[model samples]
Target: MTEPQAYLNGAVIPFSEAKLAVTDLGIVYGAAVTEMVRTFAHRLFMLEEHLDRLFDALEYVCIEPPLAKSELKQICERLVEQNAALLPPEQDLGLTVFITAGHNLPYLGLSELETCRTPTVCVHTFPLAFELW
Candidate 1:
């Protein structure tokens, strides 16, 4: 089987290479927001709604994503399309978007104060297993 691809920051890469630093705020503080959208008939279902909730969560957490709504949507669609080749006819993909509050300076002891740094953006997909349902 071919490896799935993922969007990490600005690049599309293999899912195995989508690594986050151990000190990343999302890992240390859980300072991140995420959304998951599933595909139906190889098309995204309620993409806008999922993004809306993601933005809402980001707003609540004060994290600003570098990409706009339209751009994010485009990326998601592109990724889904790219990974469609690996999906079985009966299976769909679960698309996920995760935005983290960048690096954690406090964790590195670089600063006594904390601030919201550049956000880490990642978009990835996985095969949805209906058998578990």
Candidate 2:
């Protein structure tokens, strides 16, 4: 079986390869916004509402996502479709979208002194695991 894929900063790669650097503000300072949407019958549920909430959170933190709302939605859908083959017939997926305040150059001592301008966007999905509930 093939491993599922994940979207990391505009590229889709194997889920295991999707990683974040230590200098990223999301990990260093917890400066990130996230949203989770569940699938019903292999279809996304309330995606727009979730996106709205995600955007609102981004606005609250002053972080700008690289993709606009429509683009992000399309990406999320594509990601879900890409990983659908790995899912079981009876199971649904939990899609997660997270945007971080990009890498903190100051943390790496680059001297550029920029903050939250280039956000890191990631979209990934996992089985719903209804048995665990």
Candidate 3:
């Protein structure tokens, strides 16, 4: 069976291949903002509202995401559509959206930092696992 999919930056690829740099500020200093939104009957729940909060947090932290809210929303929906087919009808998914504070400038040095101005954006999903509840 094919692995599920995830969104990293502007690409949608197999979830297993989605990776972040070791020097990412999120890993080094935990400089990231995240959001979790679950699905109901295979549809996103309160996606707009969730995006509002996500963007708000990003703004508060002064992290400018690479994509606008509309673009991000479309990506999330596409990811969900791609992944949902792998699950049973009764199963749902929990969507996770996160944006990190880009690279660790000091670690990467000034020249490399110039090319890494954009924050890292990712959206991935996992089965709801209601049986555990």
Q: RMSD in angstroms, all models?
A: 2.6, 1.8, 1.1
The Cα local distance difference test for each model comes to 0.89, 0.88, 0.91
Between candidates 1 and 3, name the one with more favorable TM-score. 3
Per-model TM-score, in order, reads 0.90, 0.92, 0.96
Give the clashing pairs for model 1. none
* lDDT score of residue 130 within candidate 2: 86
lDDT of 3: 0.91
State the lDDT of candidate 3 residue by residue for 1-133, as single tens digits.
3688999877888999999999998899999999999999989999999999999999999998788899999989988888999998889999999999988888888898664687999999999988799
Error of 1 at 75 (Å): 0.8
Most accurate candidate by TM-score: 3
Off by over 4 Å in 2: 111-116
Q: Candidate 1: deviation at residue 76, Å?
A: 0.5
Question: Which scores better on lDDT, 1 or 3?
Answer: 3
Number of clashing residue pairs, candidate 1: 0
lDDT of 2 by residue, 90-117 (tens): 8899999999999887776656455435
lDDT score at residue 129, model 2, on the 0-100 scale: 84
Q: What local lDDT does model 3 show for residue 49?
A: 99
Give a tens-digit lDDT track for model 1, residues 2-32: 8889999899999999999887889988999
